[model samples]
Target: MSTDTLDLDDGTADRALLDARGLTLLVFTSQGCPNCRQAREALPDMNLNVDRIAWVDAGRSGGLVARYEVFHLPAMFVIRDGVYYGAVQASLAHWDISRQVALALDGYPAELP
Candidate 1:
């Protein structure tokens, strides 16, 4: 199934998260980052078990960047039913991303930052 993606900024991220249902892939990305571009391209086709993909431009979303402690481009976090799960640690490969997301969801939900 095709997953929906919402472009978010610091002002809108929280509201989007609050409104999100099911699994949400919250990603911090930069426009100039090559890896971020690749992530943008790969994520839509990854077939992730997520209801939506929330894209936050790190360069412009200072609040979210600091809150999430994003240290690199294309940082990904998993959220379910408006609760924060944890960061997703995986390569850009579809299978790897899917595997990592599953592993992260199995862990306890983290306190939102």
Candidate 2:
């Protein structure tokens, strides 16, 4: 399925996640991070099952960084129907990301941060 990508901040990110009807990949990134830039370029073309990819600028989203416990640049989380599925632990490769997302969804949902 086609996925939409949004560049969101703290408040907007929170609203977008809460309003999302399908699976949403919430990614935390920073401006100077090379991995983050690669993610921005690669995510749209990746064959992921998510309906939307919500990007939160870690430099600007202190609240979200703190909430999600983001210590790295390109930290990802899976959210389905407004419930948190947990962090997505995968490489930047499309296949790895898709596989990890599927595996993450198989587990029980976590409390939204």
Candidate 3:
């Protein structure tokens, strides 16, 4: 449950939502990455749900960065139903990334009771 890494226990970003099927944005960030810092700052202002975002520190875990094939900071991967759904690469504006995230969430199927 460390804040610096993705919670991979049940493949859910938030452990409390392990049984909740929905879209998750696995955001990979690194130290000294300006773009990543910017994205982090803007994310709290976005319309995204708190549980839907996973802020992972890539610099702290090289294996994670390699596993996701991420070659840049502030990389975002969408996961739905415990599967890879989409990705938004680096070098893009925070607004653009937020838009992509919204689109991804729009496509997520509603969870069943």
Candidate 4:
């Protein structure tokens, strides 16, 4: 997948994780990762209707990792009103990435999974 990575040291602002007017979804993935591939495929079908931005870095870029407080690869972060809402993984049998986005838009707090 194509990625748009933000350069943190250039003094540019990190993309707001949440937007008060609407909600956003940020799915962190890496090349050559299988689980990330499955998540990406299932994202559209899930309840989360979000503007997806794919981050290419998998911890090698400190700026990118710290930008989102990412602790691991193949992770997900959902945001609402510029605040973090949720995260999902392939291991979550009951988890659907899109549901997190939908729930956030429906007035749920930022609930990280």
How do the residues 1-113 of candidate 3 rate in per-residue lDDT, one tens digit apiece? 11222334223334433343565667787769998888777665565542466677876766667767777778887666555555664345556766776676566443311
For each candidate in turn, give its C-alpha RMSD to the true structure in angstroms.
1.0, 0.9, 6.5, 5.9
lDDT of each: 0.89, 0.90, 0.60, 0.50
lDDT of 1 by residue, 4-24 (tens): 999999888887897788899
Q: Candidate 2 has what TM-score?
A: 0.95
lDDT (Cα, tens digit) per residue for candidate 2, span 39-95? 988988886889999989899989999999998989999999989998988999988
The clash count for each model shown is: 0, 0, 0, 9
Backbone clash tally (model 3): 0
CA lDDT of 67 in candidate 3? 67
lDDT of 2 at 11: 75
Give me the displacement of residue 21 in model 1, in angstroms.
Answer: 0.7
Give each model a TM-score. Answer: 0.95, 0.95, 0.63, 0.53
lDDT measured at residue 57 in model 3 versus the true structure, 0 to 100: 80
Ranked by TM-score, the better of candidates 1 and 4 is 1
Rank by lDDT, highest first. 2, 1, 3, 4
Q: Which residue pairs clash within candidate 3?
A: none
- After superposition, the stretches of candidate 2 with alpha carbons farther than 4 Å from their true spots are none
